[model samples]
Target chain A: MSTILIIEQVLNGLQFGVMLFLMAAGLTLIFGVMGLINLAHGSLYMVGAFAAAAVAGATGSFFLGLVAALAAAALAGAVIEMVVIRRLYAAPHLDQVLATFALILIFSEGTRWVFGSFPLFLDIPVGLAGPVTLPGGIEYPLYRLALIGIGLAVGLGLWALIERTRIGIQIRAGENDREMIAALGVDISKLYTLIFALGAALAGLAGALVGAIQSVQVGMGEPVLILAFVVIVIGGIGSIRGAFIGALLVGLTDTLGGVFLPELFKLFMETGAAQKSGSAIASMAIYILMGLVLVWRPTGLFGARG
Target chain B: MKRFLMAAAATALGASSAAADIKVGMITTLSGGGAGLGIDVRDGFMLAISQSGRDDIEVVIEDDQRKPDIAVQLSDKMIQSERVDVMTGIIWSNLAMAVVPAAVNQNVFYLSPNAGPSPLAGKGCHQNYFNVAWQNDNLHEAAGAHANGAGYSNTFILAPNYPAGTDALTGYKRFYEGELAGEVYTKLGQTDYAAELAQIRASGADSVFFFLPGGMGISFLKQYANSGIDLPVVGPAFSFDQGILQAVGDAALGVVNTSQWNKDIDNPTNAAFVESFQAEFGRLPSLYASQGFDTANLLISALEAADPSDADAFREALRAADFDSTRGDFAFGPNHHPVQTIYAREVIKEGDVFTNKIIGTALENHSDAYAADCKM
Candidate 1:
């Protein structure tokens, strides 16, 4: 491949990785602080996508649609947190998983009921509709480039929130000792809701951003949800930094493996054989990487031991 | 709610002991990922029956949830418990492969509206199974024919790594005599196409042909447009069907796709069907919808000819294919697959709606390649 092609693929990887980080950050944050496995996280992502698509189609404004997505998903997260998730907070992980899984069905069916089974259209804004030429005569989609920037900004912003702010300190403290914080007059339930809403907002933002290029439809979040789980698992269960790094690793591996594995295999094997085996391995590359990581560090790359 | 109504209608009908109530069981995906296609098929079939006001037919509709095992279970229940005389309305090829064999084996006539897998057209073909839609390979073969006629020498092909995908590529290769620049298979339901686009960009291919139905096609076409790839793209009509064309929108405009039916087909039956469907559903009918409408009318006409109780008469009536099809002049091949016209449709923006207009005929009186394999 040429340098320009490689650069383009790298950017694609970064763009994909950024979206994954948006999803993984929220999931990891929830699991870290609340210790509840949220299987419905993907449903929240779908909610954001549908909301954005609907608003955008109605108003013909991408930014307005995005804001709506953030608002809708946060509201949904907060509402569910208070109503259903709050009850599951004291329950076992299995119970939490089952409850969230049930939420997935409700959200999926409910979205279908509202939006119908067909996919909705969401166009890229006129300003970002086309490609921009990059350095070394490379061309890339401006919207995707914007995604990378947003991901980095969000990553830095999350770091500041967790490390440099008072709420961040309280959150960190809650993660360490919830009972101590509660005894110290910190409203743990409200804090949990805020955190859940914050995570939901991030996922919503991700969904809105990706929906421009992908069909905004039911079950859109499912594949992304599975990938986000893989990202968090590899990054460590509760670490944003780990999630960030892990997300990038996965995006790069998946993007590059899919592009190059077959080509690389072709150098040593016949055409048909290379294409078949290369894709088979490429599809399994991330899982294989996970297995190797688990063998080395059971908790994950940055996971802490209980 | 629809199922409840159907059940209630059947119960009220059962009280009459009319014996003319030809129990028609339709098992299709009504929920989950591919629900849109199945919903269209169901609506179109029901529309035809409802428009005719035929109380002699009792249609039982069930959702398969797009699972093979569930489809198999529903097939057994519909065949044994419901004791349905005829069964139809499966959308996916795999589900058809799973349920068609057992349903037909039990002597239940299976009328396919959407999926027409090649196996069912070949040695596995049954006298009781009739495919109203084009065989899975027909549209792809038409696509290949279109590409060859357009004079594309180096083409890149991509499809999901499944049986239908394999059939799609094989069908294209069967007609198109060209040098393949590259071939690739992607994961089913994969939304990302960045890697594949990159390969398409680098492969020195002059054109691209792909078969990714539903959301997969939308994702690929949208990404391909965004990536600034300027290759000529063609594929079967599934990706360009009415349900998803709006999502693909401007990216799909000007792209050619092959189909067995289009709204613009010049026929009285098609004109009436389209007008009535639009009035009933407040949306233009898709190819799947047309197939469903035709399948329902076919069954209705057969019912008019002979009762479902007479196996030989009913099979012969269905094989005659005397009903007016939306595609016009449609007949069944020896293997019971549709021998009909395949049209090339170009995605065009009609006002604000994204829909297809007929460009040209790709195949006329086309019969599936595997029909000769059937001994019966």
Candidate 2:
């Protein structure tokens, strides 16, 4: 591959990774603070995508639709946290998995009930549509480049909030010791809801943005959700910093693996067989990476004991 | 009111007429990723059966959920319990391969509404099985023909890595005289194609052919349109069909696709079916729907000639092909798959809706390449 091609692939990987980070950040945060594994995180992402598509279709305003996505997802998350999640805090992991799995079904069917079986279209805003030529005569989509920038900005913003703010301290404290914080003046329940809503809103934002490029339909979020789980696990669960790095790593591995594996295989095998085997291995590249990472550090790359 | 009339007819025919009942058990994907296509097929099949007003035709429908194992189980249940004489309405080829072989072994007349996998067209062909749709390879071959006719020299071809995907590319290559710029098989259900699109843009190919069905096609087309790569794209009708066309929107406009039928096919039966389908379903019928409707009609026509209980006579009647098809001229080949015309369709805006209109014929009186291999 040429330097320009490699650079483009890297950009594609980064764009994918950044989107994964948006998902992983919330999931890790929820896991870290609430100590509850929420499998319905992907459902929140779906809610956002549907909300964006529906609102944008109605108003023809993409910004307002994005706002609606965030609001809808956050409100839904807050409601779900208060009702079902609060009851499940002390429940076992199996119960959490089952309940959240049930939520996934409810959300999928509920969305299908509202939108029917057809996929909804979400157009890229006219201004952001099309590609921009980079240096070295390389062309890249403007929206994707913009997503990378947005992801970085969000990452930085999240770091600032977590490290430099009062709420960040309380969140960190809560993560460190929920019982100790509860003994102090902190209203642990309200904080948990806020944190859950925050994580949910981030997922919604990712969904709304990605929906513009992909088909907005039921079960869209599940694949991304699985990838995000991979991201968090690899980055070290409950670490925002780990999520950031892990998302990029998985993203790069997936994108570059998909592009390069077949070419790599072609060197040793016949062309058609090479392409087939290369793609087969490439699909499993991320999972293989995760396995290696876990073998090396069971807690993840940045994970530490509580 | 319709229920009352059906009830009245049922009583007149006698409730004890189970022996004469031409029970058709349809197992199709009804609740998963490509559920929309299966739903359309089911509706179209039901429309034909309901229109025939045959009280003796009792249909039992089961949801396959797009699972091959589930399809096998449902087929077993339908054959053993429902005792369906004529069975139809399977959409996926994998599901058909699983269910057709086992079900047909027990003397069930398997009339395929869709999913004409290649093995069945050749050495794996069964006397009890008949494909009402065009063989799976026909549409892609027609696409290759269209690409050749359009004077494309080097084409980048892509499909998912599965039996159908392999068949699609092979079929394209059989007819396509152009130099292959690249051939790639992506993971099935892969929604993102930016990496693939980047390769296509760089490959310097003059044309592109892909065969991703349902949501995969939607995502690919949307991503490709924005990639700013202006290469002319051609493919089979899986992506261009009515169910997902609205989701694709203007991104799919001006693209060419190949199919055996279109709503605009110049036939009276085609015209009548299109109008009634829209009237009943409040949506345009897809190629899948057309296949389902044709399959149902074919079954009905065979029933007119012989009872399905008499397997040999019914099979002969089906081979006679007495039914009028939505596509003007259709008949079963020696292998019992369709030997019919495949048309080239161009996606165009019909007022507000995005759908295809037939631009020209790709292949006339086409039979599959595998017919000679079939011993049957």
State the TM-score, rounded to 2 decimals, of chain A in model 1. Answer: 0.98
What TM-score should be assigned to candidate 1?
Answer: 0.97
Worst 10 residues of 2 chain B by lDDT: B12-21
Tens-digit lDDT string for candidate 2 (B1-376):
9999999999967864654477889998777567887888899999998899887788889999889999989998998987888788889999999999888899999999989899999999999999998788999999999999999999999999999999999999989998989889998878788889889988889999999998899989988888899999999999999988988889999999999999999899999999999999999999999989998999899999998878889999999889989998778899999999899999999898999999999988999999999997
Clashes of each: 0, 0
Candidate 2 accuracy as TM-score: 0.96
| Model 2 spans with C-alpha error above 4 angstroms | B1-20
Candidate 1 off by > 4 Å = B1-20
Tens-place lDDT per residue, model 1, B1-376, is 9999999999977775584478999999999879999999999999999988887788899999999999999999999899999999999999999999989988899999989899899999999999999899999999999998889999999998788988999899998999999999887778888878877888899999999999999989998898888989999999999999999889999999999999999999999999999999999999999999999999998988998889999999999988999998879999999988898999999899999999998888899999999977
Model 2, C-alpha of B84: deviation from truth (Å): 1.8
Tens digit per residue, CA lDDT, model 1, A23-95: 9999999999888899999988998989999999999999999999999999999999999999998899999
